[model samples]
Target: MSGLAEILHDNGFKVQGSDASENANVQRLKKKGIEIFYGHGKAYVDHAFRVVVSSAIPDDNPELVAAKELGLRIMHRSEILAEILKQHHGIAIAGTHGKTTTTSLAFTVLDYAQKGAGVINGGVLYSLGTNIKASSKPGGFMVAEADESDGSFTNIHPKIAVVTNMDAEHMEHYKNLDNLRQAYENFVMNTPADTGVVVCGIDHHEVAALAGRVSDRKVVTYGLLPEAHISADNIMQKGAAMGFDVLIEGKRYAGFRINMPGRHNVLNALAAIAVGIECGVDLETIKKGLMSFKGVGRRFIRIGDAYGAMVIDDYAHHPVEIESTIKGTKGGFANNKVVAVIQPHRFTRLNDLMDEFAACAMDADEVIVTPVYSAGEKPIPNVNREELAKRMRANRIQNVHVVKDPEEFNSLVQTLVTNGDIILCMGAGNINTWGQFIVQQSKLKS
Candidate 1:
């Protein structure tokens, strides 16, 4: 939503909004001359032409109530995004994970190809230093990260649609895995049959199934599987970077290296490659763009050296994401002991995937489970961090600890980590601050 505000403000719209509290995004919008209220109130909506609310916002919000009472236009964030999609050749990246990274990579590739494209990414692209970039060039492309949490992604009909992978995510909205699969199927089918294409990750069973049903449009499958139209081979890891060879339709296309770690990222690059090729970008340009991408914020971002240990922050909330991230971290720092500090995101998710989360953290040498972040939902009985730690221990995870307080977790991490160790902070919530706090404490001690 903040990214959308920035894009609207750049396009000469009088954009002003309110947040519950001030944060980096609020400050960023303020710097862009967009009025940002620190808290929500009815007065904030008095003079607004239209009120835009995200999925997180409730109907009872004061500003939302004011908008309705005043007969002002009210729009969901997805509605605005859908409208924006119609103005350009849109490339919408969607999935249970990796949407932000893949969308940013595609944007970088298009920009490297000298195509002045506009982008609305879910997270800050570290290279661009922002989540959005608005292009003024005529007939240019617009790349966006499609959010599937609320089922609003079905509103978008893009020229090119990329599904990095599908998993049982946002179950609160879909209620079951089958429903989530159907949503993705609809998203792919919504693409224009004549001029649109779907880039899918065939490694995932659900996504591969969706691809099998895509007979009306151009569909490209990418992964390590030989059946994939665009497949990666000869994957080699060097330090924190990964190198892989890409094959397009059984012919080797190019060998590329990305600064990101993990086989999942290699799949992400393959998706970008498929999109770039479909959009007429040369293989060399695509390689350069993938190599040039620094990374998206909070997606395995190295915060700093802390007490002789390297601290990395990542937004890995789901069990699948957590497993993949831990695997990547282990591959990157093969010799270093991995200490995972995790804060489960929401109560509903924790209750639903407790056993999976416990099993996912098995790769880490030491696991520190923090209290649930509870984005907004009330806590579920017997679904706290201590129970999660107990489950991990029962699963034969050697060392597991529970720290209910963030400050205590920081102190515990300081004592547990040593020189040459990798401290991984994983969550979708404010656990990134734990990484920052550790770095600050390390600097203070130094």
Candidate 2:
């Protein structure tokens, strides 16, 4: 939303917004001179301005009610983003995962090639040093993480669309995998016929089927599989990083290095490679661009190491993401024990995918489940940490713990952790604070 706001602001549109509370994202926007309020209320609404909000906003929100009463124009965040898309030769990165990384990487390539693209990523790009960047070039294009959480990607008719992977997620909003697949299928179908569709070939049959349906849509595929148009070959993991030789259209594209540890990131780099290739960039520039990426905030970001333990934070909430992150950790940190501090994000997701969450989280040497983040949703009857802990334990996962508050969570880690421990904090909520608390406490003790 802030990225779109930046785009509008650059295009001479007055923009202001209200978050439920202030955070890093909001602070970044304020730093850019965008007016932001801490809470939503009728008082924030103005007769002279239009209103834009995410789907998470309730229909009864006071601002919405007031806007309706005033007969002012109101647009959802996706709609406004779509309006911005129409102005650029947009390249949208869409998927259940890896969209942020791929989109950021694509932005980096454009930057290195001097394309001067505007980027709308879901996470903070460490390279750009911000979550968004408004370019000074008119025809430079806009690169965005086209999200499927609310089926909003349907509104973005990009010339180039990339799907990193497809899986069952956002179950609260999507009735089932079929519904989710249909939304993605529609995303591919909705793109303009003149551009490319890069789909992940490592995905399930549903994703492969969706890729097939868009075969006529200038499709170029990628994955670790031999059939992929771009494939990662001769992969090696060496201490919190991965290096691999990339094959594009059956030709060697030299070796690429990703400091962010994960096969997911390898695939993410591949996705960016596909995008760059389709844009007529040479292999050397593409490799240099990919290598130059430092990574994004909270996407396996290393906060610090303390008392012989290394702490990493990631914005992984879905089962596939969690599992892949664990796999990445095992290969990257060869000598450390993986301790997972996971905060489930929303009630609807936890209630729907409890079993899958349990299976994925068991990969850690120790698992700590925090209470659901709520996100303003009332709790479902039996979907809480207590139940989640019970289910994970039933799988014979012995080192499991549950904490509802930050204090106890910190205490548990401070007490149980030792040297050479790899503490990975994962979630989409305030659980990110645990990394800061742990580092602060470690400093005091030192």
Candidate 3:
């Protein structure tokens, strides 16, 4: 939403908004001369032409209520973004996971081409240093990370679409995995059948199945598998760095290296390479963009170094995402024991994937489980943090411990940490605060 405010202000629209508290983005926007209230109130929207909100906002928000009473226009964030996207040759990066990274890589490569493109991602992209990078070129390429949580990504179809991978996620809105897959199909089908191309990750069974159904438009397949149209082979990982040889149609395209840690990110880069290829970017320029990408905020991003230990953070809440993150950390820091600090995000998700969550952290040498960060959801019976640790113990996961309170967490960080340890903070909520706080304490101790 802050990104929207900045984009609107950049385009000569007077914009102001309200948030519950101040954050880095809010401070940055304030410096940009946009009026942002620290808290929600009816007065925030008193003189507004329209009140825009995301799916996270509730109907009872004071600003929204005031807008409705005053007969002012109200719009969803997706609605506003869709309008902005129409002006450019939009290329949407859509999937259940890895959309932000893929979108960032695609935008970086296209922007490196010097052809002028724009991007709006879910997180702060390291390449752009912001969520939205608007281009003045109307009808030029625009790369955006499509939000599939509320099924709003179907509102706009891009000239080229990249499917990183589709899984059974956001099931609250989707109701079932089949519905989610169908929604993805609808999103791809909306793309221009004459010129639009669908770049898909065939490693995922669901996404591969979706590709098979996409008959009207061109589909480009990318993955580790040899059968993929664009595939990565001869992969190597060395402590948050990866080198891989790219192959297109059973032939070598080029060998590329990236700063991202996981083997999973290879799939993401493949998607970006496909987009860059569609935009006429040379392989060298594409390599430059991929290799120079630092990382998305809180997605395996390093915070600080304490003695010989390295503290990194990530926004990996789902079981599949968490497993990948833990395994990737261990793979990167081979000699170091990876300590997995996990805080489950939502109650609905925990209730749904209890078994998966219980076993996902098995790769880590030590696992610290924190209380569920219920993002406004009510707590479920017997599905708290302790249960997760219990289940892990039952699954024969050694060194599993439940640290529910802040004091316990602080002590755990201070005493349990050792040299040659990768302290991984993984979650989608205030666990970032823990990561940042741990780093701050380490800095103070030195």
lDDT of 1 by residue, 228-316 (tens): 99999999887678899998888986579999889998998899888899889999989998888888989889899888899999999
Candidate order (lDDT): 1, 3, 2
Which parts of model 1 have CA positions greater than 4 angstroms off? none
Candidate 3 structure quality by residue, lDDT tens digits, 152-239: 9898778888888887778989998778988899888878987889999999988899899998788999999889999998899998
Residue 299 accuracy (lDDT) in model 1: 88
Name model 2 segments beyond 4 Å from true: 194-198
Root-mean-square deviation of Cα positions for candidate 2 versus the true structure, in angstroms: 1.7
Task: Identify the leading candidate in terms of TM-score.
Answer: 1
Question: How does candidate 2 score on lDDT?
Answer: 0.82
Per-model C-alpha lDDT, please? 0.89, 0.82, 0.87
Would you estimate the TM-scores of all the predictions?
A: 0.98, 0.95, 0.97
